[model samples]
Target chain A: MRALVARGLPVDFTWCEGEARARALSEATGAVGRRLDLTDRAALQGFLRAVVDEGAPDVVLHCAAVSQARGLQDLTDDDWDRAVEVNGRSAFALCRALGPAMGARGGGDIVLVGALDRGQTLPLPVHFAATQGMLSAMTMALGKALGPVGVRVNMVALGPLGEGLSRALPASLVEDYRAFSALRRLGTAEEVARVLAWLALENTFMTGRVVTANGGI
Target chain B: MTGRLEGTRCLVTGGSRGLGRELCLAFAREGARVAFTFRRREADAEDTTLRLRALGCEPQCFQGDVADGAHAQAVVGALTRAWGGLDVLVNNAGVQHVVPLALLEEPDWDLMLNTCLKGPYLFSRAALRGMIRARKGTILNVGVFSSERIVEAPAHYAAAKAGLRGLTDALAREVGRHGVRVNMLSPGLLDVGLGRMLMPHRVEEYRAQAALGRTGTAEEVARMAVFLVSDENTFMTGARVTPDGGL
Candidate 1:
């Protein structure tokens, strides 16, 4: 929200798991923030309808994902379902709902935000990497399916950053990530957000691509 | 000289028909003690069994859902008890639905993900215990090449197969030190199983795009699959081998 607003783009809506955080984001970025459970299909459809009614946005940036570090033996069906629903299925829903509308109106962009660990040998949960893979492939398929309609879909895969899920990782793991990168340092959220903004706003003739911002990892 | 998979104990999921059945026949011919899983395909399973028997190899067929953890565990346990240990596993069962995203429903998405992605995860998790213990095993996941290319395919199918690719990479890295090799085989536009469902013009389009000027066959892909899981596959893991005729 802050990144788009900083680019002089009006932020229409934002969603999170917590009502308080949603309200804080709304206040901070002047975008309508709502608490949304992505696992609820009805709620997601309603939200999509509301957004479409508000005039199909020029750019749809999907950055929402749920991940947990669990070993294969410890991961349950529920864990798998949660990650797939929030990380994989929700992104598809967003694209399916907003893509045709944007395409019909001449052109638009849809940028999916993913983690670099999807292609790495990280010790992250299988579900996390799997959902990231799903998102990446969906971006490619949608790019081809919607391109004729003038909607360009791409993905921005972020490396270990100093914010969000990286902070939740173990200190040792974080240090390893820092060492694994060519820059020898973790990236900032702003850096990733800038990449997302560029893909969503400025880029043309580049569809169905995964632009990695992983500090050369 | 002995067969490539001589004395090997292998299990293939969804081996009743399509590429799975072809893989089973290939493995059996290579002297593997083959066991396969089928879901509600008694006739197909019987045919596969008869063919394997004619090849002079006894094949075991288990009927169950690949996505069920308990069933996966039970299948692995049976194989382990019967053959002492399982040397190879092929996650080859999958279903395809070609609806557009606008018409795709939750059930379709779940069905695809459950079969193509979670089934592999469940079976791999179940089999990994024995593989890690024995310090020797190979897992070959069947994937689709269309996921990596700009072809007309359902998002759900692409997502599921791509997710399997991710699982293959991560699991390979996790267990490589344990002497287990994991790889994915992505075949493109074959003339069997789901590929037979494509329109004639689409098939012609795919063939024209291929460097080989033709689509691939399941038997040709099965040959590659045999080599990947055989002793010949030493020193290769965390890799994706595409037998898609250069598509």
Candidate 2:
């Protein structure tokens, strides 16, 4: 979000709005932040309408995710429900609310930032993987639906962040990841932000695709 | 004058003619100290060098087959020695033989795969050494539009191009931590290079099919190529950007 501001792009923040971090970021960036629970479809729709009332943006980025991880054995129905509501359902809700307007405008870009689990050989948290997979499918389907109308739908699949996970992981594990990659490193948030900006702004012909942003994982 | 890639040390493979030639010219115009590979066309390479010089950029020309690992090593070695370190690499050397799979011989298949797939792989391997140390570099691989489909006669060509997607994704993930980016640029039918000769009978049909109702220009593709490797592209890696005028 800060990276986008640095690039001189106008950005609006929309989330459940309780975290001090989100509030501070919004204040620091002078971005309009909305407090809307994505689980409620009507609230999500209303929030988007309010966004349009402020200003119809050239790009609407869906970067929200419930960063909860639980193995399949310990997962319950509620866990699945929470994951679906936060990660999977909200993406579709945004598309349904915003897709038509963007289409009517003759062109717009919708970039969904998804999780790193892309059927990799390694084991993953079942619910997180499921929602991520769902989001990936929806991105492709929406991309095809909106492509002819000039609205581009794309997804950016990211791996562990350099600032977040890299700081927490042990040095040995970090080195393991590096050895796994050809470039041998993790990705920075600025790098991912740059990709989102490019897809939204500079990309001319690319549509209906997943731009993977994992360091060669 | 000052450009986005000013003072950048760059190398482009198979830059004697066609789309590759345009890429070389465009890079030179952007203030990059450019070195390009030519397999056999000495005259074309000389002409390209002269054109770069006209643009006020000192351009180096190397003759080698990128598919041969030794030649790829030599190309990278010479560039590193001349320019100190390589910042950008465009894997554009490619060859195609438009023949049916039934008639495609072992050597022909080898030629297509080796040039299109193995060449990029070998060059990327060599380039990564310096790039890893620098912790900042960009690699662009040139591919055809039919990367995911079988629209042309040469199945081997399509296969080779498709293989690049894997290479791009895998390499991007591995080197991204190092601040290096790798991407594939798949261009659609153009009025230049081998595209002019590819499916000559069906060129008009392909043009008509595009949303723009025309074939793309090499300059158009070159512009996108520059943007992909430029400083402006901060977040794009493991991506295959196709500028086929919406085919």
- Looking at model 2, give its docking quality level: acceptable
Model 1: per-residue lDDT, tens digit, B1-247? 1397999999999999889999999988889999999988899999999999999998989999999999999999988888888999999999857778999999999989999999999999999999999989999999998776778877899899999988977787678767787888888878786678877888888766554456777887886677678865444466565555444
Worst 10 residues of 2 chain B by lDDT: B206-215
- Model 1 chain B lowest lDDT segment of ten: B238-247
lDDT minimum window of 10 residues, candidate 2 chain A: A164-173
lDDT digits (tens) for residues A154-204 of candidate 1: 887777788787776778888886565434567787766755765576554
Q: Candidate 2 lDDT, tens digit per residue, A137-211?
A: 887778767666677777888766677423644566567766775456567888778777766776655556676
Best by lDDT: 1
Give a tens-digit lDDT track for model 2, residues B127-226: 9999989988999999888885556536888899899888887788777877898988888887686576676668877765554446778886886677
Candidate 2: fnat, from 0 to 1?
A: 0.35
Badly placed stretches (over 4 Å) of model 2 are A52-55, A117-119, A162-185, B1-4, B25-30, B40-56, B68-74, B105-107, B125-138, B149-153, B163-183, B187-195, B198-247
lDDT of 1 at B54: 98
The CAPRI quality class of candidate 1 comes to incorrect
